[model samples]
Target: MRVISLQPSGDLTLSTDAVKPSPRPNHILVRVRAFAVNRQDLKIGPSVKDAGVECVGSVEDAGGVKGLRVGATVAVLSFGEGGLWKDYCLVPAKCVIPLQVSPATPGSPLDPATWAKLAAIPLTFLTAFGILDNLDLRKHDRLLIRGGTSSIGLTIASVAKALGAVVATTTRDPTKAPNLSENGADFVILEREGGIKDDVRMMFASKETFTSTDELSTPALSTTRINDSAGADKCVDLLGVNTVQDSLLALKGPGGICCLAGSLGGSGSTSFNPIKDIPSGVYLTTFAVDRVDMGKVPLQEIVDRVLERGEYRLNLDRIFGLEDLDKVKDYVEGNKARGKVVVVLPNEL
Candidate 1:
C-alpha cells in the first residue's frame, strides 16, 4: 500500500511501499476518508517511527472488530503520530471511533466538512481535557491557559469554558482575542511574553468581582486563591518549555497542578528552581494522550460527547485530496494553515 512515510527524521514524504495489510484482533482497517492534524505531530522532534499520528477516516475493512462495519464512517485517533495521510492504514480497533456514517437528508444543512471540523478538535482537546480530567477541574477554579492562540490551547480554553470554569487565556496577538473571547475565555490577557508569574496572578485575580454573584456555578476550588500570589488552581500549558516554569511558579497552594501537554515551544530543561520556584504543595505532571491507553478511555464515548453537544468547534483550515498530497504536505510542514488541515479521499471513497 502507498503511504506517507517519514523516511528520515524531519523528512516526511509520500512513497509507495508494499505491505501485508491486516488488522490486530482488536484493530480495524479504515478506508480513510479524512484525517486531521494536531500540534503534537508537528513538534515531536525525532523518533524511530516513520511519521506522526492524528487522523480521521472510515472503516474500509475490519479486523472482525465488533460494533463497526465496512463502509461505516469513522475517524481515527492517531496515537503514534497517526497514519491517516495514506489511502489505507491499519489501526487498533480501540483507536477507531465511528461517526454517524449516515448522511442527513437534503436541506438538512448537511455539511460535508462536518466530520473534518469535528476531527481536528479531538486530539488537542482530548489532550487538554484529558489532562484536566486528571486534575479534577472544577467550574469555580481559576484556570490559566498559556499560548492561547495555539489550537490545543484554544481547544483547552473552550472545553474549560463549557465546563463552567473561569478560563483566562494569554496571547500576544490581540487580533486573536476576539475569537478566544467569544469562545468562553472570560479573561484575555494581552501578554508581553515575559515575567508571566505576576501576569498570571493578575489574570486569575482579575475575576474576583464576580465572587458575590449567586448565579455563578463553579467546580470545587479554593476561593482563597482569587488574589493571592499563589493563585490559579490549574495551569494548562500546551507550549511546554516556554511556559512550564511560569506555570510551576504561578500555581496556587496545595493541589495546584501544572499539566504539561505540549512541546510546541521545544522540549527539555526549563529555567527555574524546582525547589524554589514550585510551591511544596504544587503538583507537576507531563501528560501525553497516549497515557490513556490502558483504560476504557479509548472508546467512542468522548468523541460522541463532543459531537452530541455541538459544543466542540474546529477552524477547518483546508481540505486536500490524496493525489494533492504534495501540496498538503507542504502546507502542513510550513504551518501555513489556520486550523485543521484534512486530507479528503476521492469520490470513490
Candidate 2:
C-alpha cells in the first residue's frame, strides 16, 4: 500500500512499501478514492504517520457494522485518527457516513470529477452545519459570515441562505466579492485591516425599507437608522481571535449570537475580559469539529442538499493527483485556493 508520510522537517513523502491496515471491531476498511486538503492538515505533528484527514471511499469490508455493506460509497470524516492519505484506510464506523450516488452504471465508482466534488463536502459542510446548529439559526434571521471566501465560510453562507436567512459576508479581496454573492451572500463587504463595523452599518442604513422600526424582525427591510443598532442578528466568525472583537462590534446587540468557528486568520493569543468585550445580552460561543458527535450530525442530509437537491454549490477550487501532494500543500499554505482542494487517488493502486 502507498501512504503519504509527514517528515520531521515539514515535508510530505509518498511511501509505497507501507503495510495495509485492517479494521478493528467497530471499524471499516475503506478503499481510498479521494481526499480533501485542509489547513488543519498543515499543523499535524511529525509523530503522525499518514497525513490526510477527510476522504470519500468505497467500503472494502463492512467489519460487521450494521447499515454498512461492501461496495457502499461513504464519506470518511476522520477528524485526526484515520490515515486517509493511503490507498486503503481503516476508519471507525462512527466516523463513516454512507452516501447515495445515482450513477449511470450500477455499483460502479463515480468518475474522478464527481469524487473530487464530493470530497470537498464532508469536513467543510459538516463544520458549517455544526456551527449553524450552535447558533440556533432561524429562518429570516440576518446572518453574517467572516472569511466569506473560505470553503467552510462559503458552506456556512449557502446553508444559511437555504434556511431562509438573509446572508452578508466579508472578504479581504475585492475581486472575490462576486464569488461570495453568487454563493448566496445577499451583501458582500470588502474587509479592511481596520475593521468592517462601519461598512456593515452603512450597508444596513443605506438599504433600510422604512416600513417598520423593528429591525431585528426584518433586517433586510428594517427602518432602523445607521446610528441605531443596525447589525447582523447572527454572525459566524471564521477569522478567529484577531477579528472576534470587530465581529462583536458589527453584530446587533441585546440578543445577537456570534459563533467563533475557524482560525483562518491565525489563532494568536489575545487578552480578554468578557464583561468589557462581550456586549450586554449578546452571547459568545465557539465550535470545534473534534467536539462534534458523528451520530448527531446530519451528514447524509447535508450531502443530499449539496449534491442531490442542488441547494448548495460545491466550493471545489482545484483537484490534484496523489503525486501532486506538494502542489496541494503550496496552494493551501499560500492561501491561494478560494475553496476546497482535493486529491483523487487512482483506483489502479
Candidate 3:
C-alpha cells in the first residue's frame, strides 16, 4: 500500500511499501476512492503518520456495525487522528458516515467526478453546518461570511442560501466575486487589510434612522452607538481572531451573533477586550469541530441537497491524482483554490 509519509523536517513523501491497516473491534476498514486536500493539513505536525484528514471511500470490512455492510459508500473523517491518504484507512465505525448509494452507480463507487465532489463534503460542509447551527440562524436573515472563498466559507454560503438566508460574503480578490455569487452569495464585499465592517454596513444598511450622537457631548457614548450603524444580522468569521472584532461591529443590531469558525488569516492571538471590543447586546462565540456535537448535523440531508436535489453547489475547484501531492499543497496554501481541492486515488490501487 502507498501512503503519504511525514518526515521530521516537516516534509511529505509517498511511501509505496507501507502495509495496509486492519480494522479493530467497532472499527471499519475503508478503501479510499478520493480525499479532499484541506488547509488544515498544512498545520499537521510531522508526528502524524499520514497527510490527509477527510475522504470518501467504500467499506471493505464493516466490523458488524449496525446497518453497515461491505462495499457501502461512506465518508471517513480522521480529525485529530491517523489520516486517510492511502489505499485503505482503519477508522472507528462512529467516524464513518454511510452515504446513500448512487442509483446510477449502485453497488459500486461513484464516477470520478462524483467521487471528487463527495470528497469535498465531509469536513467542510459539516463544519459549516455546525457554525450556522450555533449562530441560531433564521430564514431571511442577513448573514455575512468573512473569508468567503474558503471551502468551508463557500459551503456555508450555499447552505445558508438553501435555508432562505440572504447571504453576503467577503473575498480579498475582486476577480473571485463571480465565483462567490454563483455559489449562493447574494452580495460580495471586497475585504481590505483592516476589515470589511464598513463594507458590510454599506451593503446591509439599517432601515431605521437614528441621530448621530456627538462624541464629546455624550461624555460616555454607549457601544450601542456603533450598533446604530450595524447592518448584518449574523456573521460567520472564517478569518479568525484578526477579523472577528470587525465582523462583530457589522452586526445589524444588538443580540446579533458572530461565530469564529476558521483561522485562515492565521491563528495568532488578538488583543481582544470583551467590554471594550464586543459591541453591547452582540454575542461572540467560537466553533471548534472537535468540540461541537455532530449528531445535529444532517449529513444525509446535506448530501441529498448537494448531490440529489441540487439545492446546494459543492464548489469543487480542482482535482489532483495521488502523484500530484506537491501541486495539491501549492494550490491550497497559495490560496489559489476558490473552493475544495480533491485528490483521487487510481482504481488500480
Candidate 4:
C-alpha cells in the first residue's frame, strides 16, 4: 500500500512501500478514490505525521458489517487519528455514508466531476449541519452566520435557506456578498474597517426588505420577536474570538444560542468579560466535527437535500494526485483556495 506522510522537514512525502492497514471488527476497508483538503489539515503539527479527515471511496471489505457490503460507493468521514490521503484506509462502518447514485438518479452514471463534488460535502456540510441542528433552527427563523464565506459557513447558509430560514451572513470581503446572497444569504453584511456589529444591528432595525449589490432579495424582517428581543433567533459563529462578542449582541436576549464551530481568526487566547460580552440568559456553546456522534448525525437527509435542490454545489478550486501530496499541501496552506481542494487517487492502487 502507498501512503502520504509528513516528513521531518514538515513536507508531505509519499511512500510506496508502506504496509496496508486492516480494518477493526467495527470498521470497513475503503479503497480511496478521492479526498478533500480542509483548514484543519494546515494545523496538523509535526508531532502528528499523516493528516486527512474525509474522503469519497468504495468499500473493499465490510468486516462483516450487515448494511455495508464490498464495492459499495461511500463517503468516509475519518474523524479518528488515522489519515484518509492514502491508497487504502480503514473507516468505521458507522462513518460510511452511502451516496445516492442509483439508476433512477439524474447522475446515474456518476462521472468524475460529480464524484469530486460529493467528496467535498461530508466534512463541511456535516459540521455546519451539526451546529445548526444543535441550535434547533426553525423555519422562517432569522439566522445569522458569521464567517459566511468559509466552506462550513457557506454550507450552513445554503442548508438553512433550504430549510426556510431567512439567512443573514457576514464576510470581510465586500465583493463576495453577491456570491453569498446568490447561494442562500438573504442579507450580506459587509465587515467594515471598524466592525460589523453596527451594520448587523442596522439591518435588523430597518426591518425592511432590501436587495443586495448582487440583486438577491428576501422578505422583510418579520415583526415577530425572538423571545421578545430584537435580534436573530440564533447565530452560528465560525470566527471564534474575533467575532463571538458581537455575535452575542446580534442574537435575541434570553432564548438565543450561539454555536462556536471554527476559529478562523485565531485559536489562541481571547478576552471576554462575561457581564458585558455575553447577553443575559443567552446560551453559548462550541462544536467540533470530530467530536460529533456519527450515529446521531442526519447524514442521509443532508445528502438527500443536496441531491434534491441541485443548486448548492460544493465549489472545487483544484485537484491533485496522491503523488503530488506536497503540492496539494502547499496549495491549501497558501490560503488562496476559494473552495474545496481535492486529491484523486489511482484506481488500481
| C-alpha-based local distance difference test score of model 2 | 0.84
lDDT of 4 by residue, 1-349 (tens): 8877765566777788988887778788988888888877656465747767788887888888888888788888877675887888887787787765543456554556666777777888888878888899899888889888887888888888878998999888877778787777899887666566666666665333333332343345323333435678789988887778888888766677888888887777768876778878888888888888777777666666666556456656787777677788777776566667888777666
Sequence-dependent TM-score of model 4: 0.85
Model 2: per-residue Cα lDDT over 77-122, one tens digit each = 8876746888999977888889887664666658888888889998
lDDT of 3 by residue, 200-279 (tens): 88887865544555666584652332336458989999888888899999996677899988888887988988889998
Between candidates 1 and 3, which one is better according to TM-score? 3
**Model 1, span 1-349: residue lDDT tens:** 5566544354456666647367667778876555665444444445534454756666767788778887776666766546566667888776776766334554453245665655565566667668788768987888888777776777777778778788888776778788778767888877665747787675555333224322454444414434333468888877677678777777776668888777666676766666776677888877777776523554355555566555655556688766775676678776565556776555452
- Candidate achieving the largest lDDT: 2
Error (Å) of candidate 3 at residue 165 is: 1.3
lDDT of 3: 0.84
Model 4 regions more than 4 Å off:
8-10, 22-24, 103-110, 206-228, 308-312, 323-327
- Compare candidates 1 and 4 on lDDT and give the better one: 4
Give the distance in Å from residue 282's predicted Cα in candidate 4 to where it truly belongs.
2.6
> Which residue segments of model 2 deviate by more than 4 Å?
44-48, 104-107, 206-228
Q: Against the true structure, what is every candidate's RMSD?
A: 7.0, 5.5, 5.0, 8.2
lDDT of each: 0.67, 0.84, 0.84, 0.77
| Every model's TM-score | 0.79, 0.90, 0.90, 0.85
